[model samples]
Target: MDLPAPLQWTEHVLFSLLLAVVVRSYVLYGLTGVLKDLVKFLRLLPGVDTLIQFILAREVQTFMNKVSATPVDSEPVKKAVEIPEKGCSAEELLQDMAELKALETVTEDGKVFAYVYTMEDEHAKTLRKAFDMFNDPTGYDGNDKPSARENVVNQFAHTFLHENALSPMVFPALRKMETEVISMVATMLNGDSRCSGSLTTGGTESILMAVKCYRDRARELMPHITEPEIVAPITIHPAFEKAAEYFNLTVCHAPLKPDFTVDLAAFEKLIGKNTVMLAASAPQYPYGIVDPIEDVGRLATKHNLPFHVDGCFGGFMLPWVEKLGYPVPPFDFRVQGVTSVSADVHKYGFGLKGSSVVVYKSSEIRRHQIFAYSSWPGGLFGSPGFSGTRPGANIAASWAALRSLGEDGYMQKAEQLMKTTLAMEEGVDSIQGLSIVGKPAMTAFAIMSTENSGIDILALADAMEARDWHMERQQLPNTLHCTIMPHHIGREMVFINDLTESADEVRGKASLSSKGTAGMYGMVAKIPDRAVVDEFILQFFDKAYKL
Candidate 1:
């Protein structure tokens, strides 16, 4: 950008002004084009009509509130609950908190089997401390707030600036850490020099990004494809279906064999011209059985499709399990057609929650996952994935977890988990009616009632719950899914005894009549129109959010 030495001051001024104008006009044009596309896209969204109706209703309500100020004689509505007038002292507050916390399903006894994962109590303390350290400072750009900038004492340790259109003035150390995290995950997945990726909030976000990448890539290659489709196994995590719903893509579910592995022939039949990507689970959550990733990878290569292996539950443990002489199929970048792989550090990596990595075969495909805009009045904007203000403490803690528990430590954990899983399998087998489902490739497995036995698995699950043993029930095979973790290692005897008792108690009581939760699950499964099930599930979630 050097200027000519012979140029006069007047000519230089004119040249600078002209350059500024050209740059401004170019940015404006790009921005305008993006805005137009955004408007068009928004119009197609299902929520848009609802949004417009809401705006109109809000306007009318506001107008009414202003003009019709006459008060009614009805008694004023009372609050459902009242807030305290004053804050309690620390000890008192904590004591009160403990009272509420005591109501939680899982406690020191560790009866619960799902949702929560814990290592040593010391590890829990360390993660909690890490979270508290950065709980006050945000990862937003602090350049505009000098006071906040002044409080940023440990740039490398505390805050990480927003990744989207990351400010040049922000701390560079955090950025470096993020890059290293991606690189570490990529290496673990057998990625090469060209592999690139981003750290997402969780496995769901990672899957969403992958879906978006393939959808956009397909759009670029085949503009005529208005309705892109994703071919995935029915056992694949529901996140794929959620992503499809959000992005207006269709998901074709392939059936699974008796072993819970996806049927390759049926999968091939589902593939069509509109198929943008192929997805399968690496040790699927339902039965903990690894899909035929190598076979699916070959199919992807033949169809020239991007293959995504969701290892969110097993990514961190499968490698070590393979190293420990267990048979693990090639499910990562080592598989020729695996365009992306998602691994959750939170699950088996023993990292804090809200940490997962989504890696691509190369930066080329990753570019499609990123969102960028050039025409904002403030400045150009770009974000790697679904969020703008993600928590950085999770990233820091995730890194710390990895650093604290090196290869040997993870292998030790895997060994313990695997041993516990095998023991649990034996324990289940010992029960006359219950047996482990499929060949569990990892720490997770499911127990189901044998056909020869008259026991009902769901009834047995309800009996187990009655005995204060929490077990996650599955629908497809009517099994109780269990994930063995570090906490469950020494409690094997307790688990076995309780399970044996529960099974004995429920033996020959019912004929799989589907009572309680099982009844709901059975009804949903047998429904002809899945939309009714969807609505019921949606209502269930709505109830969960209620106070």
Candidate 2:
């Protein structure tokens, strides 16, 4: 029987898959879970022969936010019109904003997702005022001149209004403040003088810069390999996958064990000649279990690879947890093989959004992250980190926020957050059909249906959402995520009550699983082809901008 080229290729894939399965079941003599991880190393095309093996399994998908046909809080614009015929009065604009603000997702429940919600409204006021004053950069004909307003803003925020971080020579104050910020974060992470990094816009930018640094470094050292790869746990942040997609590298995901930590043996096996970098998460987002950083660090040392610990979720809070006497594993530059570490200052550091840091073990390695071009019309052009026209206001605001919290404030908040999280964990465990995922090492954890409980966790999320409690939905085991903040401290019982009611409401009603947000994620989870999944997400994005 004559077969098409694609079919023949599929045949080969299936044959290999079957042989691997037989070896695992018969020859291997143990449910090691390494075989599937080894199969993940293969970069197959068009997604055919392997379909049978993994049609029901989760695909290696990439997305900033999950696409839902029935998206939550996607309030449509009130009305569409051309550019206004006349400028509206300020009073009219404020009235319009007030009406819109009333429609916010958080109702009286106040269970909105701010795991470390602190000083948000206060910091937001400064940021808003700063952004408002800079409506048009050109409006500043006399903007450079100092005023009483300048002193007032500086006294509170230290913001360099209308300032650009394009060139530090032009804004020496920004350069100095940014230096001290980096140094402070490095010292907190237990790094010495050798530690170096840049304050990026956010955690994504920090991770992107780290990947770029190692990729470029490998280009110089290992030029023979055109396509480089990163070996990381499946639980690694999607930013790494995003980095790989942007930088033309592959992310080989290793499987997790029963506890949801990366299978270290499988992780080590994935490391080959082409592997340029290794990454582990400090309390990875889904499970909130810090991947075995010390073990991965040892692997990085043995393989002579640059390791990155993504502490974006835990970086700011871990030290406080450790000081509070929580047994946190050493996850910073203190580990021998940990070459770079990323932490989101915007998260637990109490900084406003658009602030994160990725520190390195040495200045030499950090140098590769910088981009420069001499032959240009603008003369020597250079950018460290992603943004060229970086906002000086963000740097100033972040600095102010950090200084305001100080060590004592953060520790106090950590104590509150830990107490709330543990309480929430116990409350969640008390639920009959639901369970918290993994041994949560920090503030975040996911709630999942217990095995054969017949509880659709996604349906439970919809039930919570309807109650005006902003919930986070997760997959790869179908769960809902929750992180306890200071605000959540007194409201554990409220959430627990809502959760218990939701569970009871959904019990024996399997039909609810095919409705609303649950239906969307459930449908997507079953698809094996990554291209199909990509297209499904693309349609959601396309529709968003269809107007």
Candidate 3:
């Protein structure tokens, strides 16, 4: 970056001018706008930049080793950094890997909240058995001709676990099973006969697919529109932001009302000509508060825009919860102006992980979700979603969960889960310093500290974590989230007792003998400089991969 020898003095003047410009920009627009530019331009100041890097490196190391949770170590699963010269037998290797097994959360007792959805041991065994049966079957051979035994199991789920969905023609069974799964989800959500969608890896992929579909749809239909935008509530999942970033679309986040629902008036105001799509959550994850989907649908219809209902959290549970005589509102295809819906089978459908469906109102709109290429040397290529090699076992197991549960089984579990959800809501709200955030419509809810409550909510969460509870900490008025299910049936009383005790401990901790570190659980909420928080999180993710 140095200039020629004769012009070295001019470099100092140029640097000073650039520094003034950056400082002015920071003062005018704040860090979010100028932070990146400042980094790029100021990196040339070696003395100052070196000091900043040293401080950042030390802080990142402390954050990783001291503040963050112990990383799930991968060392025990391997003998060395590279593959072994001589591999050991499967039985021997598994026997030697006790450390890896010990590192897993003991979720079997249903103590862990998120990232697990097991109904019963027998249920899991059934799905696992199905996966094993279809994985690596002896039905295909690498020869000039097909195997002689191919006809024997042609009608079965036909080695689908090992089949590549990338080529549906080669694996018709995978196509059939996936089609049926999608159809079942569509019908369950009350999509009419014209409903069409694709199986995705998870809820995020489903959301991304819907975003891409509408973005492309606008490109074709509104050709004059150059810049695209998405309008969704602030409570919408982070996946929508990811989609907007990837597709060069601007996302206008609508504010929230007192009830934790999206402010419908502000939502409508944000939708202008460039708004290509609208999204609302059915029981959004943070507070389990279902946005007024029916009202949003009205706005969408009035504006003639495509609307998507993110039913990832409530899709499977709300249907049955409604059938159980609960006051669940319309949030699915039955509601008018809902052009597409995303539901996660892995969350409450009691299926294998990584299975979700994004259903559109018609095949006409869903067609835009597909990607096809013709000029590649690898032959013609097309994929339904982002994934090329999908696990057929997920599709089959999802089908199995829906078919096996039926209406009777899902209803039974829904009733119990709803009972627990309501009971916990009542219990937690009655606590001295804690209150439920809002009137939750379904199985999840958030507990926040009251305005005058002396309790430090994050300290209470830290105490809860000490008792082996995996607390999902949330911010912006700082709440702790819990997603209760059938496994949480009889454990409500104990959970309430622990939370009360934790709150008590937090209230008494202000009189410590010596000063202590700020509650790490709540520090992110207190930090005003979002750039520093972003860098800290970036470094945390970097550390996660090393272990």
Candidate 4:
């Protein structure tokens, strides 16, 4: 083996190279096998499917704890108990509710803004009696107590309760009420006699229905199109976004002009064959400025697309405001090419919650609002709106509220609300470093501070809250909002005094910290990444369910 030293050295070198290659290959194969085993072990872990759920639960629980720490009135949790020896009297339940109501600070004569639209004691008593008379359990059975159910309360209950609108044959009254409500809203909006529509749960549902209708209509007209879009002003309600998410539609938000009205030129450029609907708000929620619906309607007509007027906030009030001689523009079906409208009866309609109407120009258009499931075991179910079983009591209460507040009653209330709104607007405008947003003709208005005024709107909101005033803050321009009601008429001076004092105090502060929505909105605006903002919102919802 040691015959020649050089030959021996060369052979040794070759052997070392072979050994190195083998070691390297073995090392790589071991690493790859270990990784595969690790992945398999992870998959084999017991209840691994619940890993994501566990993480979500922990996150949600943490969020809830944070939310619970915030100072806000929360209802006590009432645990349901098995029937003890005997059931408690109904009177006891009523007493508990009364005590809870007494504890509530935002009742009538309280300085809370907009929530409780109180009337005279006499009127309240009348409404209470109406509710009691119609609150009988027999009210739900229409055929059994036809004559007793003839009144608005019983009739409304009979129309909605146990009577699934999903089955028109089983419940004809639901169909009638839905038709009548739509027709009445259409008439108020100045739609032609041929106009029609469906009843929805609220403003959001009505808006959703309209968007869905337009999306389907567009799909039918354009078979080759997979992506449908809607063009709306930036002021449009967020419900449109929700609709777009559910129906897989795109939204093009046009900016507002300097005066806060919709920029028609931007809107014109946004519309294309894929554009299904064009939306305009009658006194949008943020600035309370009515979009130029007439101009928007003209554009929609030119493009052969349906125009939707989102009057959910102002629909019930503006018609009466116009009758009272307030300067309100035509933002309803009166405008040609305006095909659909959403109006909430719960807000200005003074109806109980869970009632609103979405009206259309014709039966053909409204037919799209229907949801039919013929193949289901439930037997040819078809609901006009989203819900399966709606509370008849709400419908009855709405009917009662509407009938009680006839045209004359509405006119008087509208006058008072308009007067109070104008007074507040004027008072805020007079304050130093404050300016009204736009020419609002109804019960809502907003105020923004002058440039470099050092007045933080969120700080002012907190200050107002300290005085028991629940004024809301808006984003984008960063302003404070107020929706005046009839109850606010005599309290204008009190509000003005508080506003002036709050503005002066907040302006003097070195730093302002936001609370509630104001703080959330502030953070959202600063976040450059929209995904992070979405996460924040999702975390907020998770927080809402905390104990």
- Choose the strongest candidate by TM-score: 2
| Clash pairs, model 4 backbone | 166-382
lDDT of 3 by residue, 1-547 (tens): 8679768878788878878877887888887647867776777776877888878767756644452224423222221121122323334333322332343344456564443344545676687577545432331122324232222222122223433466554434455557767777888888766788898989999999999999999998998878999999998999998899888898899999887878888999999989999999998899988889899999889999999999988888898888888888899998999999999988887666688999999888998999989779976677889898776557755654565456776677778888888888988988898999988888999998887787777667777888888888787767889999655778889888988887877875754212232356355656899889989989999999896
Per-model TM-score, in order, reads 0.72, 0.73, 0.71, 0.70
- Regions more than 4 Å wrong, model 4: 1-164, 513-521
Cα displacement (angstroms), candidate 3, residue 160, comes to 3.0
TM-score of 4: 0.70
lDDT at position 273, candidate 3: 88
Residue 88's lDDT within candidate 3 is 34
Give the worst 10-residue stretch by lDDT in candidate 1: 76-85
- What ranking emerges by lDDT with the best candidate at the front? 2, 3, 1, 4
lDDT of 1 by residue, 55-74 (tens): 87677566544533132223
lDDT of 2: 0.76
Better of 1 and 2 by lDDT: 2
Q: Scored by CA lDDT, what does every candidate get?
A: 0.73, 0.76, 0.74, 0.71
Q: How many residue pairs clash in each candidate?
A: 0, 1, 0, 1
Superposed model 3: Cα runs more than 4 Å off: 1-159, 511-518
State which candidate has the highest lDDT. 2
Give the per-residue lDDT of model 2 (tens digit) for 1-547. Answer: 8799999999999889866765675555554445554454443445653674455333312111142112223332233211122323334433433442343232125543321232346675776677646531211112345333223223323334445666654444566557667777887788877678899999999999999999999998899878899999999999999999999999999999988889999999999989999999997988888988999999999999999999988998998899899989999989989999999987887665688989998888998999989779956778998888877667765554455456776787788888889988998999998898888888888999998787898999999999999989988888888876655767888998999999999987999989999999889898999799999789989999987
What's the distance in Å from true for residue 538, model 4? 0.9
